[model samples]
Target: MNVSSPLNNEFAISRRRKAAMIVQMMISDGGNLSLSQLPESLQELLTDELGAIRLVDRDTVLGVAEEFIAELGSLGLSAPGSRDGAIAALSDHLSPTVAARLREQMESVRFGDHWHIVIDLPNSRIVDIMNAESVEICAVALSKLPTSKAAAVLAQTPGERARRITYAMSLTADISPDAVHRIGQSLAKEYGRPVSSAFDKAPAQRLGAILNSAVTQTREEVLGGLGEDDPEFANDLRKAIFTFKDIPARVKPTDIPNCIRTVDPAQLSSAIASALAADEPVISAAEFILSNVSQRMAGQIREEAEELGTIKKADAEAAMSSVTSAIRDLVESGTITLRDPEADTDE
Candidate 1:
């Protein structure tokens, strides 16, 4: 867990070659390598007298040297060794044009922060890193990462520890860039390789999906902890979760008939009646349910509901709750699927 020397050794030979090449380039150009002449990545690696050079293997010296030449050429100034000489020097190591194109491609490729490095790590290694840090620090670190990555890591962690980490993340409001960079550097040094991948779903939505599968007590505890740390964030997470009430708006109209058939007819009847009896009935919910059922079935349910008269508010709610819970279960079990309204509109 000690990250004193986390950099991968696999790139050591290449790094040394690049470092030596950079030194050669500087010497050839009459030691005129200026900070402004380097790519941001190379600039960050340089120090006074190159005292602390830590070349990232992601780029080669030839590549950076080409960029340096192009930058100088743009300023209408020749490189110290002459642009031709520098180009020849770079071409001696690698094709200058190809290297420059490769560098350009590298520049275009984006990698997420150090947290991404952690996610790319093996689960056992990720757990080890998490175990090495305090819950608060780990949570804050995880919170800064993409939600899918954070959730994947948390899901792999032990349940109790995961809960604590979730609580800590919710409480964390601000994390400095320095801290994140350091964490990422340490992780990259220890466990990462140069790689890139796309992110999916917002953190709230991903976390909501994970929580939806959780046991009620654990879900409540995590939400309660989140509520304590940041109520607004907790509210957002809650909204991300699709509940029974969300069905009217979220469920596909085509899927409704099958969903209705999954519930008990009597239970559906009582639930509909209770919904109708509410001071301001959820007309959308009633209509949605009725619209999905056959006309005869819908009519029969209406008659049965009328005979039932005014059921107790609690009874009505209980009946409705059961139907709602059933719908959620079906969705979770893949028996039904709800289309996201926002996603539809976006299309």
Candidate 2:
């Protein structure tokens, strides 16, 4: 038979029972515990032990808390048990933008680094950030971007300022990695700025897009009036417009195949015929489309147009509009990019 002395009886609590008593004692005294920080398995065990155990003496509860505190104090350091937990711990040490960026990039291999995230920013955003930030900051961001992206962004940046930023790049070879990372993180945050307006595109872009589907005469008439009254807006609208005549200058040769798929084969043939029968720029645009397509396909388009006989002026206008509409769709979806129109190119 086993005999228990009073001292043994007082100290007889099991580990789990002691843990429960300590937890209850802490709660009773108004201490808040973030029990959720523990590993889920341990949390479940603690919850179950806490619920199953009933009562403990005041001395036993006090002793358990002392032991728990002693053990915690004896540990030199404690690391967060998970990657997310570790990020949360150091989040206070970082700027909010960098910290949030770190959390987003933690699970993504695509970004690789902060500079790469900035590289992935649209060229327009990069230009905006360059315009808003100091010349030195712009120089750092421009240097960090890939050669191709940097060149494209610089093309859009103001000429004299871009030249200054470019020259500043020569001095950036000795910049510290930490400075570059912080600059990139700041730019990315800027890129993430919320749009205050409901519309996704600018007013001029919206007006031009609506005009794209309108008849050629309607587009010209509206622009003529806008030109007299609102020349600045008209100029912006002209830059945004993509007409059948603008095809050769704005659309790419390689993208011709995708446009062919976008419109019906018969419709594409009719548009080309319509353009061919029209004036200089329209004829060139027709030739651009036909030449870029396969030889067999080009031959077929000519054959189909011939079989359809002389297309009427109204029919031709409608057909050409269809082609332009398909190109506009491709541009909107980011599937194809338009070439920058030359200064002399008329809308």
The candidate that wins on lDDT is 2
Model 2 clash number: 0
**Which residue runs of candidate 1 sit more than 4 Å off their true CA positions?**
1-185, 189-232, 279-281, 344-347
Query: What is the per-residue lDDT of model 1 for residues 1-347, given as tens digits with 9 covering 90 to 100?
Result: 43233223433435434454567567768896555545556655644324443443435444655655666688955564444335434644775456443432332122334455466676666676677778877876676557776677788788888888888877666867777666666665554442333556777878987776554456679899999999988988887776445667777777777777767877788878877765343656887788777899889989988888887866665677667667777877998876664564531
Among residues 3 or more apart in sequence or in different chains, the pairs in candidate 2 whose N, CA or C atoms overlap within 3 Å are none
* Error in Å for residue 234 of model 1: 3.3
Which candidate wins on TM-score?
Answer: 2
lDDT of 2: 0.80
TM-score of each: 0.39, 0.46
CA lDDT of each candidate?
Answer: 0.65, 0.80
Give the per-residue lDDT of model 2 (tens digit) for 14-85: 787677767777888899999866666788888887776554556655677788888989999888867767
